[model samples]
Target: MTSVVTSETRFVRSGDVDIAYQVVGQGERDIVVGIGWVSHLELLWELPETVHFLRRLQSCGRLILHDARGTGLSDRPARPATIDDLAEDLVAVLDAVGSERAVILGWVDKAAGAIALAARHPERVEALVLGEALATTVARDDHPEGLDPAVIENLAAAVEQGSWGTGALLPAIAPSVAHDPRVAAWWRRWERMSATPNMAAGMLRTLLDLDVRALLPAVTAPTLVLHRSENMLVPSAAVRRLAHDLPDGRLVELPGADLAAFFGDTDALLDEVEEFLTGTRTGADAGRAVLTMLVTDVVGSTALAAELGDHRWNELLDFHHREVRAALARHGGSEIDTAGDGFLAVFALPSRALACAREARERLAAGGLTIRAGLHSAEVVHLGAGVRGLGVHVAARVAASAGPGEIRATGTVADLVAGARAEFEELGEATLSGVPGLCRLTRLVDARGDA
Candidate 1:
């Protein structure tokens, strides 16, 4: 339903509490979303990534998002909610929306309640999709792969000690976007609006205490378990066991470490979900995507060519190209184009792009050829073999502004990779030729560690 707005929140009563929910789009089937920890019904639409994720799910079916009891706009009970209470609240929201059966899309720690519901009332859940989900958070003798109880306890203690509204949890949830100033600001407000410090801490403890391993066999619906290949938050053994125990479950590990389903490679994650539900994959258009553009130019190319003569210069330039290409391949980059004594590439992540730039610089220097590079992150339009957008121009201009052997990045790129091995020194504002206004540029002083 294009007319459906995310801001128009509605309420559904489950027992004495009022659960807040919003509906968007219409399709043959319904998809209900349940996130781990806390979430704000309206705040979920603030970020572009989150909006895109919700829309992608909507593309395949009618989407339902609700705030569980004790969090967000829902009534915060004095006591914490249990798995049974959460299941009832979910059912209440489904009934309010007139959904007979819907695909339960649960994320991270919230999957326990969804699993319990699926087992208890299989008729209400058509299918299940769990992303970065854990059957249990605490380690048991039978499930030793689960998280240490002490670690979760320490985290809950920190949450109780005034760490709720400061955006401290963003890194563990979505490290890719946590360092971004805009994202950090939005997250701080999200945390404050979702729950108070005590409420969040209590929820953490309750979620950790939940164990749904015994319910796996009773969940008769087809299940898809999606996990990130490099996710550091959840142990791989726990996820593997989750898939193994489910009667009809299949595991697919995608590429990324962000535990938050809306961040990282959301399009890839959605592809799997859509295919599982619809039996076919109608993927998002690749015409435009948020990518990091990297541009590199050799220093004094014309003069050096004249000094070394055409034959020798050609050999060195050829070696430089080979070295740069090698670096790109090593750092997970796609070479978009190459101009005279210059190269252009793009990376899905800003950290990888930064590392590629650094590696290329060092490789070229070793070969007696020095280069300057620039990186910028933005939405670029892909046409034919190359990309076209103001972002590409900004990257080229930034590269032109860099000195020999220097790697420069726009503020957008720098902000995205703040916690990575890279470090930047602000170069203030520069008039990027042909682009509008002044752009803040940061010099990549060091990007030497593993990204």
Candidate 2:
């Protein structure tokens, strides 16, 4: 069974504050992950993507995950925390774990603290890795690399009044998984658990005001700076400057606009990190993969069963099941489950799944029966002789939303089967129950101009 990770979280005294930290896996080398802005050590494990990312990192080295002072489970600073405080908090965690030297992978504002530690306490930092690293947040006349002051202002406003605790900012940070209801809901709770609206806004302002450009030159550790090519917040030229300013820095610009490291194309991001840390990029787990899902349900099955009585309905259902099994075999789909008058199956190719769904609906219609089908492509956890994941839930929801004799799919299905000669009619956005946000649904039309 695929389950969310739970670790024994502990706290260490960092000056006057108690910083919460979790140690995962055991290795000769240690990896201190500096998650920036806001985070909750326990709530983050609720996300499957984060679990996968952490497990992969554990494969490479021991992971030292912690929430910064004044955030998550840590004690709030009596005064506005400074960059010096952030660096010291990290050092304190290292001491608690007995890690004399470790690779520091800093993200966003936390990168400033990492750079400070590398410069101030060079012996403790074995190597440095940064993602979406910031040199300066506010633009200045002397430093053309800084961000526009308005950008930070708008963000502060969002956290303070607009969308704090709602996960509305997820789209801006991680657009790739914005449509997934499970992730959306978890992120909403994560936001709430991380900090209150006022405290979050205050932390945002404090972190943005941090400037680490001066410390870059003093970092003696070999540094790898990773930044997204189409980052929404940080300008590419500015990140390039950050790399150039560092004495022993190497810059690698990855694809995607998501500022969060574990969001879009996570495998690609992890590949880089693992290679940089251990000189080998570990392969992904064999049990997890992206698969296209198809779910079909007989419309008004209860009424039909009542009208036809037990014997007649049973005979008809048996025929329908046989036909569906034949269709699955013909299209290379693996039938995962059959619940009452519904069928759930998975296909390796989106086009094949679409074709099978269309064929099964047509076959059932010809037999005086009709089914509404839904298709979606997403990552799935392969269970013993079956599969499960958010994609399966999404497919079931899409199927439920379809009209009788109609086929519907998420926008992702349309994107995946682009050249399959499939026609799709926009069904617009829908607010599915149990799903956090609106999802874009599309009606799949038959290629032969048949409804």
Candidate 1 to truth, TM: 0.66
- How many clashing residue pairs appear in each of the predictions shown? 2, 0
Q: Which lDDT values do the candidates have, in the order given? A: 0.86, 0.84
For residues 1-451, write the lDDT of model 1, one tens digit per residue: 2323554799988999999998887889999999778889888977766776786788787889999898999999997889889889989999999999999988876688789889999999999998776777777877887876676788789889888899887887788898899889998998999998999999888867888888988999999999897887787788888998999998999888898898888889988998898877664553478899999999999999999998999899889889999999999999999997899899999999998988898888988899999999999865435676899999999999999999999999999998897889999998877999999999988766858
Error of 2 at 199 (Å): 1.6
Model 2 segments more than 4 A misplaced: 1-5, 78-80, 285-451
* Each prediction's TM-score versus the true structure: 0.66, 0.67
lDDT of 1: 0.86
Flag clash pairs in model 1.
Answer: 1-25, 1-26
Task: Give the least accurate 10-residue stretch of model 1, judged by summed lDDT.
Answer: 1-10
Off by over 4 Å in 1: 1-4, 286-451
Per-model C-alpha RMSD:
15.7, 9.3
Tell me the lDDT of model 2 at 375: 92
